[model samples]
Structure formats: C-alpha cells, structure tokens
Target: MSGTQPTVTLSGGGADDARTVVRALEGTFGAPDERPGDGNATVHTATFAGETDGSAADGGGEGAGRLSAPVTVTVQGSPEAVRRASETLARVFTARDDGAASGDQEQERELHLMP
Candidate 1:
C-alpha cells in the first residue's frame, strides 16, 4: 500500500441511505474505522487492507490478491447515499460507475450518486 490511502467520499444521503451504503461497503471492504452522522446526514470512513476475504491462509484461493492495495471509503450522508440506495431499494447497492459525476479529475475515489 502507498503512504496515503485512497479515499471515497459519498455525501448528501440521509440516514437510511447512509446505512444502506455503509452496509454495501461493509460487504465489500469490511467494517469501517469511523462512522458518524445522523438521519439528516452521515459519514462512513473505512480503510481496506489486503483482501477482505479470508483466503490468504488458504493458499490464495479464488478472489485472492484482488485487493492487494489498501483502499479507503467514506460514505457521506443524505443525497449521495440516497442516490446509491435508490439503485436497489430492496437491499444495499454498490455502484460500478467510473466515479465521474461532477467533472472531477479524481473521479476514481470520488463519486456523487444521483437519485
């Protein structure tokens, strides 16, 4: 991993959406380091080190070495999270976009989901 971990900041989603996004992220990168926010807005920040799946001890089984680098995820609240949640209102949702929503150069780590 590099000295600075990559971070993904999702903002504007409400509490429910925040929870949904957090759950979806957890499913991918594991639990977060810090989760703070309310129904109005929330923020979830987590750092993923190595493969989240417990396959390293199994001689690098399937899906192993997929996330060799560390990555960070920060889910903001209300609007962003709401947009993410709406993708699949039944359960959690993880976006597959190129992270290009607001014409930002650092789109790989920054995303602004829409409802």
Candidate 2:
C-alpha cells in the first residue's frame, strides 16, 4: 500500500531468521516501514515503505545466510509485487514454493525457507 512493495508476513522461524529474511528483502525493496522486532512468537511481519525505485539497497544477498529452521513466509500485494518478492526470497534463501492464491488485484504466496 505504501507504494508497490508487498507486505511480508513470516511465521514458523526464530527471531534471527525473521530478521535475516527481512534484511534480504531490504536489499531489493529498501528499508521496511517498521523494522522487525525480536520475538519468540509464531509470526513476524514487515512492511516495506515502498519508496525506493527497486534499485539494490543494502543488508543482504550473497551473505544473507540460511535460517536455522524452516520459515513459512506469506507475501501479499499486486501480482508484480508478489512475483518480485517470491523471486527475491527464493534467491536469498532455500525456499520451497508451497503455493499461491490470487485475489482481484492482490496475490498471496506461501513459501518455506529451509536452513
């Protein structure tokens, strides 16, 4: 909603893993609207400000590192946004395309990122 970047929701991983994943996306989507917090909760969410021009930002890629456990991430936004997020995550993590559901103008995809 901020621009064109998808709002990503992540569950089933530790706090470190969540931040790492967010950091990876930051490299492509710029900083998130609000940074991911430290937590043991089942889910963590990050919303990108979507102000950047999709140029490579900073924080991850090539050294993003893998998660200690599997992480299930959901990306919701326009079709283009969903596709870009999915592609970025797949490149940064060991990801499995669990599935995707589409809405009128929004698309949601679920992926599993493994260590």
Candidate 3:
C-alpha cells in the first residue's frame, strides 16, 4: 500500500449497478477500505487493499493472487460521475476487436449485468 493502488471503475448503468459490482467484489476481496461516491452523483466507489490468502502455497496457483493488487471501483450516474467513471473504467476495461464482430452495429452499447 505504498504506491498507488490499482482501480476498477464502471459507469453508465446506475447506482444499483454500482452496488451490484461492489457486492460482487466484496465477496472476493472482503470489506473495502473506502466507499465514496454514494448518492453524491448517483455514483459509488469502493477501495480495497492488496491481499491474498496464501493459497499459492496450497497449490491453488496462478490466479490465486487476483487480489494482490489494490483496487478501486466506481459506477456511473450523474454527468460528472459518468466522466470520472468512464476515465477509470477505461483503465480496467478495454475495447477488444476480436475480428468476429457481428450483430446490429447501430445499436448503442451499455454495461449489462450478468447472471
């Protein structure tokens, strides 16, 4: 926790969306250190310290250290929220041009909650 911790920001969905993502992350990383945003901009943010369960020694291997990096997540809402969320989100999520592009190219793309 010396340098800047990594962060993951998600926007455009809503407050509920932000809560959903926060819940999902909490399930894996335990309680976060900071939960800013809230109703301030319909935006929400959560920060977690880098930690691991030492499962690597138990042969859990590879991705076992997923939480080894500090992370901050934000969901979008208001205009300001959208701007900030988008900037941070871009750092975590990126556009992948897989060549196999298909479907209605005219349709606007937004974040969708998955089951």
Candidate 4:
C-alpha cells in the first residue's frame, strides 16, 4: 500500500460514506488528484499531494459527515504522512486503529471509521 503520494483508500461502506471520509481528510491534506466514489462503487481511492510541512487541519470545516455505515480507511505514505492522516481522520470521525505495517521508508495504517 505504499505510494509516491499519500493515498487514502476507503472501503466497507457505501460510496457516500467514502466521499464523506475523503472530504474530511481533504481539509488537512488538500484536494486529491481524483474524485472519490460516485455511488456505485463500494470502494474508493484518492491520492493527495500532501502538505510540505505535514501540518494537519484544525477541524473548522462545514457540517460533519453523515456516514450511512462504518467505513474502513487505509492510509499509505511516509510515516509522517500516515500518522498525520490517521490523526486528522480520528479528529473528524469515530476511528479505531485496526493495525499498521511498515517498511524502510513507507508505512500503512488501517482504521475503522464510524459516525
């Protein structure tokens, strides 16, 4: 699950749920290269050119996401990006860290998101 850019892959829920979580991350990581789910796909992925300083959002966005069901999010990137992404998502949604795997330079973390 390593990538050049920090990538967020969302699954285990409706497309809307994926969009919701992705949008939440956007507040911290900026817009992604592609759009999120479109309604038919249960799984969606977005890759972001993460901030240079790796700063996170303060959660001053619009209304909170309305998830139809629980979603599983996998974040893959450098260790800093992965950790920042996990913290940003946890701030927006009810998140439970599933686990993590690491390599020399990249890492991946799985989280369960509920709303």
Candidate 5:
C-alpha cells in the first residue's frame, strides 16, 4: 500500500472560513487515535493563497466584496482515513446560495484532492 499522505485543497470565501475549515479538519481527523502527534498526527502548515474580487463586468459590487482564498490543509495519517476526511469536508463546505445570486454576488469555491 502507498505510504504517502494525501493533500487536499479547500477553497473558502475568506481567510476566516479557511481557518475554520482547518480547525474543523483537525477536530475531525486529529483525534487521539488518528493524531498521535498532538503526540500522533502532524498538523502541517495552513496556507492562504490570497483573494480576488471580480470586476463589475464579471460580478462584483461597487467597492468591497466577500473575500476568497485557496486553503491547503495537510495532516499525516492513514491514506484511507485522509480520503474519508477530505470527502466529508467537501460535503460540509459546499456552497449554498442564500440570496446573493440575484445580485450577481454568488461565490464559487472548489476543493481539489491530490494523491
């Protein structure tokens, strides 16, 4: 079996959301049995890839807008466990339109899984 840990990229509406997701992941997969390095699993660094605001033509508001960033969350654990954790994260973070669609303010975030 492969002995390498998987890498997952989560797109968040902002840095705050990214931080929340990272914390959520640690809580989900960093349990005593999984994360021995709290003495068990290693908490890799979390990175934010910056945010971009679309122009008026593309669908941005007059001035400021909701921020978005690419968040990379890394944890060391069994491959099976990591994959399961990532899938669960995807489901939890899926975007939902509350009422911003009409204003052309919908934000799209995607999660990428890497082996």
Candidate 6:
C-alpha cells in the first residue's frame, strides 16, 4: 500500500473524549473531519479506520472485544499526512497513559503495529 492514502484510527477511553482527541489531533493537522463529533460511544474507543484496502485481512469487521464503528479519515495529500495523523493519535494515547499514571492507575495502554 505504498503511496496510497493512509488513515489513522484515533481511539480513546470513551466517546466524547475520543472526538475531543480527534479534534485536537485534526486541528494539529489543520484539517478536521467534515462532520466532527460523529463518532458514537463504543465500549471505549473512537476508531478512525481508513485505508485503500477493502479486504478481510485489514481486520475491519465485527469480532470479539471490538468497540465502536470505524471513523474513516480520508487522506488526500502526501504520505506525510498519514505520518502526521498517526503521530497525533499516538500522542493522545501517551497523554492518556500519563494521566492515568499520575492518578496511581495501572491500566495498560499499548499500541501494537504489525507489518
């Protein structure tokens, strides 16, 4: 999927905060979603799923422990857009983890990427 439009799913601990995080990240990218706050309250996520791959291998289907519907963030620029988007989401999770840690919470928030 080289040179193809890349998407980053910005999931969070809840619905409202997920949108906030997306907005924050999108604002950082300077291109917010057309319909912001569209994501619904998942078990605990705001999954922004977008990509050119239309297959089962992408893992975009209903399965156990899967929360919320996918929020497709269309990429229309250079590859750097994808990288920036992914980085924005990554920072959000990191901040969340830091917050939880500050509260003496030991929740695990891991972002595993497999190529």
**lDDT tens readout by residue for model 2, 1-115:** 4436789999887888888888888766778877668756778999876734545743235476778889999999888778778888888888899999998878999999998
Write the residue-wise lDDT of candidate 3 on 1-115 in tens digits: 3111323354444555555454444433334576534464544556544323533212212221222222334332333332333332333333221122123321112333322
Q: In terms of lDDT, which candidate is strongest?
A: 2
**Model 6 CA deviation exceeding 4 Å by range:** 1-6, 10-12, 35-78, 95-115
Clashes of 6: 0
Q: What overall lDDT goes with each candidate model?
A: 0.36, 0.80, 0.36, 0.78, 0.35, 0.35
What tens digits encode model 6's per-residue C-alpha lDDT throughout 1-115? 2333233344434454445444544333333333235456443332233332334222222121322433323222334444444444444333222221111321222232211
Model 5 RMSD vs true structure = 16.9
For residues 12-53, could you state the per-residue lDDT of candidate 5 as single tens digits? Answer: 234454445554444333312122112222233342221122
> What is the TM-score (0 to 1) of candidate 4?
0.84
- Highest TM-score scorer: 2
Over 4 Å off in model 5, which ranges? 1-13, 31-79, 95-115
- Candidate 4: tens digits of C-alpha lDDT, residues 5-103: 689899988777877877777766777788774668868999987553334366522354778889999999998788878987887778899999999
Q: Sort by TM-score, best first: what order?
A: 2, 4, 1, 3, 6, 5
Q: Which is better, 1 or 3, measured by TM-score? A: 1
**List of clashing residue pairs for candidate 5:** 35-40, 35-41, 36-39, 36-40, 36-41, 37-40, 37-41
Residue 94 CA displacement from its true place in model 2, Å:
1.3
RMSD per candidate (Å) reads: 11.2, 2.4, 12.8, 3.2, 16.9, 14.6
Worst 10 residues of 5 by lDDT: 97-106
